[model samples]
Target: MKNIRDSHFKLHTTSPSYPILASTELGILHAKDHGEWHSINAFNLSQKLRDFIKNNTEIFEIDDVFFKSGLYFSDPNKVWIKCNLLTGKELREILCDKYGIYLSRYTKKHILINFHFGVTEECLDTLISALSQIEKNTLSRNFSLNENELSEYFVIPYPPGVPFIFPGQKISKNDINNIKKHQDEKNILIYIKEVI
Candidate 1:
């Protein structure tokens, strides 16, 4: 075990794995016993949410956006919704502030919703109601990016920290469109040419 630990630390430059605590191990065992029920419930809720979003594509501007899931099977714990209308941060803020439904922001374009074991149908109804209310709200306009002028700046999106268009990299029309589509107020685009 010592040799294995030494080898792991040497290879990764990090501490070796630690054993699970007694309470955590027992919790894992308990979760294993009830995992299937939780999974099924989560799956059902996710399906319902998906259906709601699909039916309201006009309101949500979700025609281009899609859920990260297979045709028939999907992981029940979390659902990744790619939203074209709103940034993950914007969606997170709206859901949390107005409806009290907090969500994880996976990226500028993607929002992650988790359905846990204790989540109920009433919770789902609340979320649906919140979404309906949001439809009546107006979305803020975004600044347009000119394709020719893009060469003057490096454009990057945070919360999935990566550059959409970087300095010295050739920017195409499609790239500009995609960047404009995904760019949100929460994640500010840094203009690095002046800084450089």
Candidate 2:
């Protein structure tokens, strides 16, 4: 049962080794916006992305990146590294305007997780305990999840395209039977990769 749920949590048509990601391998993909941090270097963009990921662990990947030119340089420095990370649909729309990118496919509407990145057994156990207690109302809206909410759901937190919680992967049988128990009330908007 856990295995089945795990499978449901993953991206469709993927396997243990070959996971999907939001970013594509478009070498030298030019930034639609640019600043002092980086000019026209893919390596620099990738590194900046890595740094962003290090800070924001919940983001899955940048759907696309563009360079922004002619922005004020701050005291430290000014660089426009525009990329998409999985996030609330509303935020994505707002960011699209800030970055000058139209709201299109880059919007994020689901919570994504990766299998790698040190999600230990103990961490998973703690998460499960927390998730079971979240009320449907609390899960609604954009709010920081409490220990209970964060712990209840275990996200892989990398390789943004692939899924950590998928169908077929075993999960707590109680959770499986009582899908409504968890607070992800907007489950219809959420996408998990798996084969039923």
Ten contiguous residues minimizing lDDT sum, candidate 2: 74-83
Candidate 2 per-residue C-alpha lDDT over 67-153 given as tens digits, one digit per residue, 9 for 90 to 100: 555884322111222222224454344434443323333223432222222334443344223322221212333322232232223
Report the C-alpha lDDT of model 1 over 1-196, residue by residue, as the tens digit: 7965565556553443444334566778878998888778877997788888887643343222334645654455566766555666887788899889987555776677778877888998998888777654533234445666546555655446466676666668887767766654454444334322
**Over 4 Å off in model 1, which ranges?**
1-26, 61-76, 139-196
lDDT, candidate 2, at 193? 33
Clashing pairs in 1: none
User: What TM-score, over all chains together, does every model reach?
Assistant: 0.48, 0.23
Q: TM-score for model 2?
A: 0.23
Q: What's the true lDDT of residue 178 in model 1?
A: 70
